[model samples]
Target: MEEKMNSGLVTSSRKKLTIVDTDVHHGYRAQSDLYPYLTKFNAERFAEWGFGGLSTHLYTSSGGLHGQRVDFDAGEAGDGLGTIGDAHYCSTRLLDANGIDLAVLTGGIAGAASALPDVDYGSALCRAFNDHSMEHWIAKDPRFRLNLDINSQDPLGAAAEIDRLGSHPAVCGVMFSCGAPKPFGQRFYHPIYEACARHGLAVTMHFGSEGEGVNPPPSAAGFPSYYIESRQLRPPAYAVHLASFIFEGVFEKFPTLKVAMVESGFAWVAPLIWKMDLDWKGLRRHTPWVKRLPSEYLVDHFRFGTQPLDEPADPEAIKHIINWIGGSRTLMFASDFPHWDADDPMMTLSDQPEDLRRRIFAENAIETYKLSLPAISQAA
Candidate 1:
């Protein structure tokens, strides 16, 4: 297969602003601490079944996981360390190196780690991972932010764990998987929303999963098998979640809770949302329980990231998504940094007119994450 050609430099003279690297995989730090704890039982059992553990899949590119793959060549980007550079290539590093006011570090690998069935062993590993993150990645530097990856299989238990750590002040939200239950709905995951609501924390549903069977695996009936299936799964999942909350009354159940869909490209937002609202109006009698348009419920509850944007990169699509979601106020910018094909972030608004750029890159995150400027001001 031919390698993708990297795009030209992100051309813009616009001043940089605080950026949040919402999706990151801290590989070396994770490998050091996470590798040793995998019990021989888990490792051996996985091996017996032709299954791979964190060590095999995540640490090695030949395996399916790609944490190491993305960083494999970042060193040549001028940051020194190979693929995985020191702090600068990491989220916290970028925050200091760039004018990024805050950083939210998330894991695409840890979700898979939590899915392994060791129960006590698995959960223990989860704690170790979070503790490692808190101590090394987040605590090592003061400005970086951390969001707990709440493994979805046992959300209630996960929620309790989140509540226990909720007071940490470093963890700002819980990250749930897209299509977590095969079909999406918050009912099975209410405890998480409850805990988050009680603690005034936000909930982020990030795209991609490493086959943690908390929910049923996806089916190809209407889905594709490639990675793009993951993208296809998101809109429908969001639709189900929104429908459940509207029809099943989740927001009424918990007034303060908020959710953000991370790494879910915004291209589908317009048409999907329009279909949702239209269906709600035209098909209401089928589910009289729902009192509002799906669009209304969604605007109040969801925030979407601009990374992993769909293939076309059409400006019209972006505008449509923003308009359908109740304006540019509903979208947030994300770098998804260090990952292969990561939006250079600087390019997020480069092609757009100035006003839309400001809304997506800055304003929306402030409103959604409830971010506030640091007491010590920095260059905008």
Candidate 2:
């Protein structure tokens, strides 16, 4: 059954299946949009310094929405990996079109902001972005939710920012760039996690600004020579953060906190957990705060987004591997909408069983994020 909206549009009944897209990138058309929310000093700095952020963009395609579908119009300019668009365009092309119930807006620049060497500017940029998001994006649609972007380099400021906006009705979680100079588990970042746990907000690690600015190489071995290599190393980039979260006992400290890994394939998850579980048996003494098998903590506290999901030679191979890792319980549906590689909800897991599809598309996210589903209003 479909539900009709005030706009005279229809969507799949929420009662039937609630499609909560975990990863939807949104942002300002340019830094100028942030000026209204930015402090005078920051606004002036932005005017002069321009976007002082840097990343290993040298290895990735800088065109076509970062290789996103450039063909689809976001109804605003700078669809080329930008923040110029709004909810109406997205609704027409993605949400209502796909019958999606809710789509979390994971603005692309949040992670990149953290990559900046200038901590104050990074934090200010994030604050402005957060304010801008509330006014422009989240305010525009109930279907939209925001993951407040943060600069990990300024733990005190980041924690303060969390306390400032953690309780907002539309804000869902906090996001960190995977290009982080240190493991997420390090004490340097604890203040941010502590605030997140206090507010019961999940922490999201996403790809951005790796191998540039203050951030170290994307991989432990170091930066890759080419874009393809950079793409392949994406999963490992998350692996380091995951390992830090587990080994550093971030989960043990913040039992209520959750972390969602996005834009990273799930296939690498199984191997990493296997080795951690095995090594933890002997290395448990080194980190005594960890009270359980590493795998148990990860399974309990972590969630994964299925975007850019790996499609192996055998179509069924992903299903089997997903089951081995965590299956429907751990996976959540994400379209990465407006991006060239955005996965359509219907086309993404078509081969999987309907039961798993339903769980991944909605139930799992609701549980992990403790989502507050907005009341459904039917059109007369």
Candidate topping TM-score:
2
**lDDT scores of the candidates, listed in order:** 0.58, 0.78
User: lDDT of candidate 1?
Assistant: 0.58
Q: What lDDT does candidate 2 reach at residue 1?
A: 40
lDDT of 1 at 304: 79
Off by over 4 Å in 2: 1-15, 53-56, 60-66, 74-84, 377-380
lDDT score of residue 239 within candidate 2: 89
Name model 1 segments beyond 4 Å from true.
Answer: 1-16, 27-32, 35-88, 91-93, 96-98, 108-110, 117-119, 182-186, 210-214, 222-234, 237-239, 285-289, 311-314, 353-355, 375-380
lDDT of candidate 2 over 1-380, digit per residue (tens): 44443233444444366689998878667657778878898899987875574533656573465555776664554423644366677766667666677888886566667777788888888898888888878878887888998888899999999999999878789988788778888989999988998888889878878877877767768867877777888887888889998888887778888899887868889998899999999888999999998888878888899987888999878978888777778899888766667787767887787799888988888887778777741210
Q: TM-scores, in order shown?
A: 0.77, 0.91
Give RMSD to native, each candidate: 6.1, 3.2
Give me the candidate number with maximum lDDT: 2
Error of 2 at 4 (Å): 17
Per-candidate clashes, comma-separated: 2, 7
